[model samples]
Target: MKNAKPDLVYFSGFYSEATPFIKQLRAEMKDVKFLAGDGVKNDEFIKGAGADAEGAYLSLPSPVYTGEAYKTFGDLFEKETGIKRDASPFVAEAYDAATVIIRALEKVAQEKDGKLVIDLKKLNEEIRKTELDGASGKIKFDARGENVGGETPVSLFQVKNGAFEQLKQ
Candidate 1:
């Protein structure tokens, strides 16, 4: 890195590994700009990287949440976990995933031999047929089971003053 100095460095991994790697990069190439994916968009990375995290850029596949329900959820989440909502946007996504599963289970699961049972095939079919207005956005899966609902604009953010700030692209 010292001999062949690159102007920009892009990371494709999670924060646990990124924190140390970024620290080393900052030490070696202080001027080089660092960029990473949504995997490193959490407060843990900022906390771990400290001041070195400043000026680093990150991207998320989904746009920053704008729904009113999500705003309430974010507030409650901050109050309960003491972590800012922007630091971890995956919370709503995870909730939506769990909700999909619970809804499917409610529709397909039945009592069998004094124990709850669910056919895997039926459950998969039900999950595939899901369509709900989730906290993140409209939840609908394509034929291949990929989420086909809502616009997936790639959201860009920068680490500044110990927080992730959304950057207008």
Candidate 2:
């Protein structure tokens, strides 16, 4: 393989599996670029691959709560859990999902003659019609119950100087 000149290579596997391959291949082929999936986007991959990870690229759905505008939620989470920002990509998405569900429940809840009643059918419909600004950007569902509108951002990052840096458009 050293005689062959390839510009790029793609690795698809969990970090544990892919990191060793990346380290080995990078040692042999210094000029080639490596692209990986979301599995290798964590700290373990960087630590395992060491210097080989530099210049590696990976792309994944952008976690919407990392920006300056979302500092309040980030601060609160860190304060409560003692976890730093960007520790998990799903935190903001989970929060947004819960918010959507709560909003739907509120809209579908009704006050009877005296007590509160919740209709499951109406709650489902309300959930389908949910549209709001959430922690993970705008939350709007299509007929298929999939997010269809607003900024669904994908981020492309490169490992540089032992850290992942988001590339500008």
Task: Indicate the TM-score of model 1.
Answer: 0.91
- Ten-residue segment with the worst summed lDDT in candidate 2? 63-72
lDDT of 1 by residue, 1-169 (tens): 7788889999999999999999999998998999999899888999999999999999988744788867877788789998777676588888789989999999999998999999999999999999987778888998889998878788889988888888954
* Pairs of residues clashing in candidate 2: none
Question: How close is every model to the real structure, measured as TM-score?
Answer: 0.91, 0.71
> Considering every candidate listed, which one attains the maximal TM-score?
1
TM-score of 2: 0.71
The global Cα lDDT (0 to 1) of model 1 is 0.88
lDDT of each: 0.88, 0.79
lDDT of 2 by residue, 45-150 (tens): 8888899899999877874554543576668878998876566455667777888889888888989999999998888889989886666667788987898746
The clash count for each model shown is 0, 0
Strongest candidate by lDDT: 1
Instruction: Show model 2 residue runs off by greater than 4 Å.
Output: 1-5, 63-69, 101-126
